[model samples]
Target: MTTTRMPRSGSLPAVRRAALVLLAGAGVALSPLPAQAAAGGGGPSSAAVAAAPAAAAASSAAQTVVSTALAQKGKPYVWAGAGPNSYDCSGLTQRAFAAAGVKLPHSSRMQSKMGAPVSRNALRPGDLVFFYNPVSHVGIYIGNGQMVHAPRAGDVVKVSSFDRMPGFHSARRLA
Candidate 1:
């Protein structure tokens, strides 16, 4: 197995370098351990290297989903409204994921069951965070314990702290 070193810090912008490092970590995290044996050495196998691009793709998709949802910030939260204008909780998530080429149901309850269940400690940007016992509300997590959500009627889409929201039922990762 061969390894490549990252470019010197001076060669890349801080943000770009950080992203590369994070994506590389993501690749390792996503790679199946069983495939590491194919290399016959200590380094990542070809299978792990191949999985890197997939991790990058998923990262990009998650960014898109988060950005698309954030772009709607301040839009009125109309019940069941999905769109270029207003949005409901699920509508916002559905449209946001749709922008990333992933289809999600318009109901929070149904959408909650569509992705891999994620633990609170594992929450990442683009993970769906649900609230209430029966999961009546949903939000797109944006990391740092913050989430973007469309609160009920008379409210607008906004970034909110998890501490402000009650009844945290569960979370899921779709991207």
Candidate 2:
């Protein structure tokens, strides 16, 4: 089997990098990791992260998912790539959420049935927003009515407004 990797780009600051390792080693499970970023800035990692409200952690998780998704913008869309360089619609969403400690199915139709149903007017960041009948496609909601998705076989990962996604099916909040 082939594996995908992302060469560390040094895009994240040194402290955040250290935080990633330290927290990952501590088995902190990257759930809403703004706590790690906060801790990296010098406060006690455990206390700072632990004291954070549940909502803060969840919000951080959502942000983490969005950032992870956006990082792949311009990556080619592959039919079944679940990757560091290329991805399919559901593959992109699965990878992003997994980075935030959420597991997802690879099939868009399966994913649509996994998370709690959310209304169009109530969509929030990190929600799995699906499109097309039979739910052939999916994307990660990034607020302001925008989503990051792998549109198709020839397209790259990109951010698009709601109008760009036809067959606006239901949204599901997984994080």
For each candidate, how many residue pairs have backbone atoms clashing (under 3 Å)?
Answer: 0, 1
Q: Local distance difference test, per candidate?
A: 0.69, 0.68
Residues 52-104 of candidate 1: C-alpha lDDT, one tens digit per residue:
22111237657777777777777888999987678899999887776654557
**Candidate 2 clash pair list:** 32-61
- What is the C-alpha lDDT profile of model 2 across 1-175, one tens digit per residue? 2122222637455544554444445433343222211111111123432343212123655777777777777788999989877889999888887775555678999888865689999877778888878789899887766777888888788777765678988798755
TM-score of each: 0.67, 0.67
RMSD of each: 16.6, 12.5
Q: Look at candidate 1 and tell me the lDDT of residue 12.
A: 53
What is the Å distance of residue 175 in model 1 from its true position?
Answer: 0.3
- Poorest 10 consecutive residues by lDDT, candidate 2: 35-44
Consecutive 10-residue window with the lowest summed lDDT within model 1: 32-41
How many clashes show up in model 2?
1
